[model samples]
Target: MTRSVYVTGVARGDGRQVVELGVMELLTRQVDRVGVYRPLVHDTPDRMVELLRSRYRLVQDPATVYGMGYEEAAALQAEQGQEALTARLVEGYLRVARDYETVLILGSDFAGTNLPAELGVNARLANECGASVVAVIGGRDQSAESVVAEVRNAHHAYTNLGCDVIAMVANRVGQGVAAEAAGALRATLDVPVYVLPEEPTLSAPTVSQIVDTLGARVLLGDEAGLARDALDFVIGGAMLPTFLPALTPGCVVVTPGDRADLIVGAMAAHSAGAPPIAGVLLTLDEKPPPHVLALAARLAPGTPVLAVPTLTFPTATELFTLDGKLGAGTPRKAETALGVFETHVDTAELTGRLSVARSERVTPMMFEHALIERARADRRRIVLPEGTEERILRAAEVLLRRGVCDLTLLGEPDAIRKKAGDLGISLDHESVQMIDPQTSPLRERFAERYARLRAHRGVSYELAYDVVADVSYFGTLMVEQGLADGMVSGAVHSTAATIRPAFEIIKTRPGAAIVSSVFFMCLADKVLVYGDCAVNPDPDAEQLADIAVQAAGTAARFGVEPRVAMLSYSTGTSGTGADVDKVRAATGLVRERRPDLMVEGPIQYDAAVSPSVAATKLPDSEVAGRATVLVFPDLNTGNNTYKAVQRSAGAVAVGPVLQGLRKPVNDLSRGALVQDIVNTVAITAIQAQGGDGDRPDAGGDGQERTEGGAA
Candidate 1:
C-alpha cells in the first residue's frame, strides 16, 4: 500500500533532505507504496520541491508535500492562511492517501505558537485519510528544562484538540543528551520516549518500519489506525481502559459492542456541541452507540471512524497496561524504536533485520530499495529446489517485480505453479522462469561447464547435464556463465551441500583464493560476525588474512564497519602454539596486506572483544575490544566457534549475507530461518547490483560486496 507523509520542520536544506529520506525510511518499514506531501514549507525557493525532484519518485505533486521553499515562504510572508495555496499545490495528497492503508503525517515546526488552521488543518487532513501524525521535535537546545517545557506544552496543546498525542521523539540532539532526555521524557511524559539515535540517520528506508506498517492491516483489533508516532499518544481499545482520563478531546478508542460506556462517555466528554473529536474508533463487528452515532453525525461529522475485526475486546484490552516509558540510553534504543513501532503499528512485525547496533552515518550512492529493485532482472535464469517454488519465486523475482533482477526458478512450469498454489503464494509462470533442469536450454550449457570440469571422469554430455543440472552445481554454472547474476539455494541442502555446487562452478571472486563462510550471529540487539565457516577448512595465515579482509569489508558494506579481532584461544603475546602462531601471523599479514583495516587477534574471544578483558590483555590495541568482525585462523576455529555461539548462546544466526562470487552467490544453511533467507537474498541482490554492468546502482555500482564463503 502507498503511504503519504506530511513532514514538517524540514527548514534547513540538508535537514530537509535527511527527513525526506528519513520519513521514507520510516514508511518503508510498513507501506510498500508511498506518496509524500508537505502542506506547507517555511522558505527557500522550492527546496522541498528541488529535493523531491532530485531524490524521490512522486505519487503526488512534490509541491504539495512542501509549499513555498525558503525564498517562496519568505515571498509569501503576507500569505498567512495559505490553505488555498497549499491545497492547490498538493493536488492529490488526500486523494492518494484516501486509498492507502497507512498515511504518515509529518508535523510542521510551528513550535506551538502558529495557527492551528495552518497546522491543525494539515493534522486533521491525516484523519480525513485515516492517517496518523508522527511529530518530531528538532531540539534547538540541550537544556533539559527546555525539552520538558516543549513536550508538556505540546501534549496539552494536542490533547485539548481531542487528539491523542500518539508519540514523542527528540531529534537532532547530541548523542550525549540521549540518556538524560530519555530519562526526563520517561519520568515526565505518560507515553513512550524514542531516541532516533544519532545513528542510522535518514539515508536508507527502514525495512522494519515498512514491514510493520504494511502488516498492521491483518490485525483483528478494536481500532485499526496507525500511530504516526508511537511515542506520542496511545489509546488501545482492547487494552486496559487506563487511558480513560486522556480521552478528553482529540482521541478515544473503544470496542463498540464491548465498551458502549467508553464510546458514549468519551464522545460526550470530548464532543459536546461539536467539539474536536480527532479520532473516534469503533472496533470488533460493532457500530457506534445509536445515540452516540446520532450525536456524532451532528457534531464531529468528519472525524475518522476506525473499525477492525478479529480480536476479542477483553483480549485486546490487555495491551494498554504497558508502562510506555522511554528507555535509558543504549545501543538497543534504535532496536527499541523498532520494537515500539511493531507493538503500536497496525502492521506485521518486520521479521527481516539489517543488523546494526551502533550509531554511524549511512553513505551515499547506496540505496536499499533501489538495490532491491535493481536486483530484479527481466531475463535471468534461476534454479529452484523441488518444493520451495513459492518462496523461491517471491525472492528470485523481487528484482523483476521492481524492475531490478531477471529471475529464473529451477523447476517444471506446472509443478512450480502447483506448488505455489499449495503454499498459498500467488505466482504465475510468466512472472518467473520455471526452468526444469531435466529439459532446459541451460541443460546443454550445464553439460558444457560440467563436462569441462568433470569430463575426464566417466560422464557423457547428457549424463553430465542431468547430474550437474539436478544438483546445485548446474545453478552455479548458470551464475558463472552470466546466464544468471546470482543464485540462492540450500533450502533442502546443508551448508557444505549448498556451497559444493557453487564452489565447483561459481569460483572465488577476483583477488582471493580462500573461500570463507561467516555467520551473522545476532544475540538480540548485539550482532557478532564470525568468519571462515564454510570454505577454507584449513587456511594458512595469508589465506586467513584474506578472509579477515573480506569479512571486514562485508561488515562495512552492511553499514557496520569492521573492528576486526582475529580470534584464537590466546591473548596478546600470550600462548605459543601453531594455532596462536597462525593467528598472530595472520594479524601481521593483514597489517602488511591491508594496513588500513582494523585488526588484532591471537587472543581469546572475550579478550579480543570486551573492553573489560581488553583493558587487562591488550590495553592500547585499536581493535582488541569492541570488534565487529571475527577472523578465525582456520575453518575449525571459525566454524566451531560460531556454531558454539549460535547454539549455546541461542543467537539468531544469519549466514553468509555475503558471498564473494563474481556475482552475489550465497549459500543457505539446510535449517535456515525464513528471515535468514530474506536477509541473504537481499544481500545477494545488493551484491548482484554492484556487478551489473548495465546499471551503476551502487556508488557507481555501489552495494555490499562479499568474498570467500569458501565456495
Candidate 2:
C-alpha cells in the first residue's frame, strides 16, 4: 500500500497553501515519484495543483488530479447521499495512489460549495483513504490562547473521526505571537505543532495578477516586472513633490491619464534606483501621449504601465482586494513562501514524524534543497568579493531572503547599493553587511597582517597596503582574520586571482599536501564528485594520490560515500600507457594512505559509471561501477570531462570547491549564474562549519555536493 498524507484546514483563510507547499517540498526532498490529488476543486482551474506540477516537475496528467468539481460533488452528495460521494472520491484517489510511491491528498477549500460539514467530510475521506492527517488552523487576527485552543480542537476533531493526526500547523499568525502560539500548543498537545507568521510578500498581489483582475492593458514592462509583488499602492492625485515621498519600494502607482508629470517623475525615481515601485496603474482607461509614455519607458525599461477602464476609487478597491497566489507564474512568491515556512517550522522534526523512508536516488533538486537547509542550520558568515557584480548582488538577495547565511559583501558600499537598487534588489536587511575594501578601518590591520605574512617574499608595508585593497585579497584576509567564516569569489576575476589570496593567507591544512578542487556533478539521478577539475595541471603520482584522499574527505564531508575511482583511458589490465601507469600508481598510493577507503583505478569512464559496462569489463571489483568519487589524472581531462558532462548530460555542476585549505575558500566560473553563486556560497559556508566529518543523514544514498556551472 502507498503511504499517503492528507492536508486539510479547519476553516477558510487558513493559508494552508503554505503548509501544503512546504509539505510538497519536504516530500520531493525525500522521494522523486510523489503524486498530488485534490479531492474537490472549484469550477475554475486549480492554482495550487498547477504550482505543484510545475515546481516539482510532476508528470501526472492534469485530468486525473481531481476527483470531481465542487458543484458536482455537492449535487451528488445531496442526491445520492454521502457514502456514494465518498466512494467516488476514494476511487479517484486510488487511481492516482496506485501509480506513485507516495501521494499527497489536498483537501477541499471551504469556498463556493454547498457540501455540508466540510471538515467532517475531509476527516472521513482521510480515514477511508488510510492517510495520515496534517491539520491546519487559521490564526489570522487570533490571540495565542485562541490559536492554541483552535489547534487542540482541530486535533481532537480529526482524532475522534478515526484520523491519524500526525501534526498541527497554526499558519498566518501575528508576527510576535508565533512563538507564543507554538509554545502553548506544544505544552498542551503531544503532536508537533508549527506556527508560520503572516508574510506580506506572499499575500501581496503581483502586477500581472492586477492586470488579469482589472482587465488592464499593459503598455510597458517585461515578464519580470509583471511578476513583482505590489506590496502597497500609491494613489497619485497629488503633485510630484507630495507624491514622490509617498512612493515606496514595490508599490504600484495609480493615477489618471492626464498626470504625465507624476508618471514621468515616478519612472525617473525608479530609474534612479531609490524606492523602486512595482509598476504604474493608470485609471479611467487613460494613457499619456505616445511621446510622454515613450519617455517613461526610456526612464524605466522594465517597469510596468497599465491602463484600466475603471476610475481611481473602484480600481483601488479592486486592487486592495486582490491577493497574490502561489502558481506557475509567480516563482519568487514560492521562494518567499518556502523561506517563511522553513524559517518558522521545525522541518526536521516534522519530516521525522511523517516516517517517510529516504529514497536512494538523489535528484538535482533534492541536492540543492539539502544544500540550502544544511547551510541554514548552522548559519555561517561568507564574504563575496565581487559585490558590485549583478549576479552576485542578485544571489545575495536570494541568500538573505532565504535566511541561508550571514553575508559580508566586499566592495565600495555606495556602488554596491546603487547597483542593487538599479536592479530592484533590496540589501537593507540586517543579515547583509557591506564593506568598502579601500576605505574600511580594517584595511590598515589587514595590510599589517598581509605584510607580516608575506614579509619573507616582500619587503614593504606600503606594497602590502596596496595589495590588500584588492577585493579578493580583502575578502580572503577577512576569512583569515576570523572576520568572515568563508569566501566565494571569481565571478568576474580569474580562478588564480580568487584562490591565490587563500594560498598566501589561509594556507593549506596541517596534514594536507596541496589545495585541490572538486565539482559536484549533479546528474538526473545522483551526484558524483569530480576531483582536480579546476586546480593542479598535470599533477605527479604523489599529488594525484593526495588529491584523491582530499577529494574523498571532501565527498564524505558533504554526504557522498567516498568510493574513489582513479580514471584513466583504459580499464583494468586491458591497456598500458604512461597515463594509465600514473593512475595505477596513484591508486596504490591511495590504498596505502587510506586503507579503509574503497578505491579503484585505471578504470574507464564507462566502467566506472555504467553497471552494464562494469559487468563486461571488471565484474568482481566493488568500486568499479559504484564509485561516487572520480579523481581525474590531470586538470586537462578533469576540466574537459566535467564541462562535457555538464553540457551533454544537462548536469548542474556546482563547484570548483577548493579542498585541503585551512579555511574554506571557493571560486566560481566567470559566467556563473545567480543560482550558481548562491550554491557556491552555501557550499563555502558548509565547509567553514567543519572540514572532514559525516554530515547528518539527510539526503540520499551518496553525499551530495555542488559547483557553479551551466546545467
499-598: candidate 2 lDDT, tens digit per residue: 7787787777666777789999999999999998997888889989999999998888888898999999999898898999999999999999999999
Which stretches of candidate 1 lie above 4 Å from their native place?
1-404, 429-431, 456-459, 523-527, 647-651, 657-660, 691-711
**lDDT, candidate 1, 338-451, per-residue tens:** 323322222211111211121232212223432233333323334344335344544443333323334566766666644343222334425466667777776787787677
For all candidates, the clash counts are 69, 8
The lowest-lDDT stretch of 10 consecutive residues in candidate 2 is 697-706
Q: After TM-score superposition, what is the CA distance of residue 247 in candidate 1 from its true location, in Å?
A: 50
Per-candidate TM equals 0.49, 0.93
Residue 48 local lDDT, model 1: 41
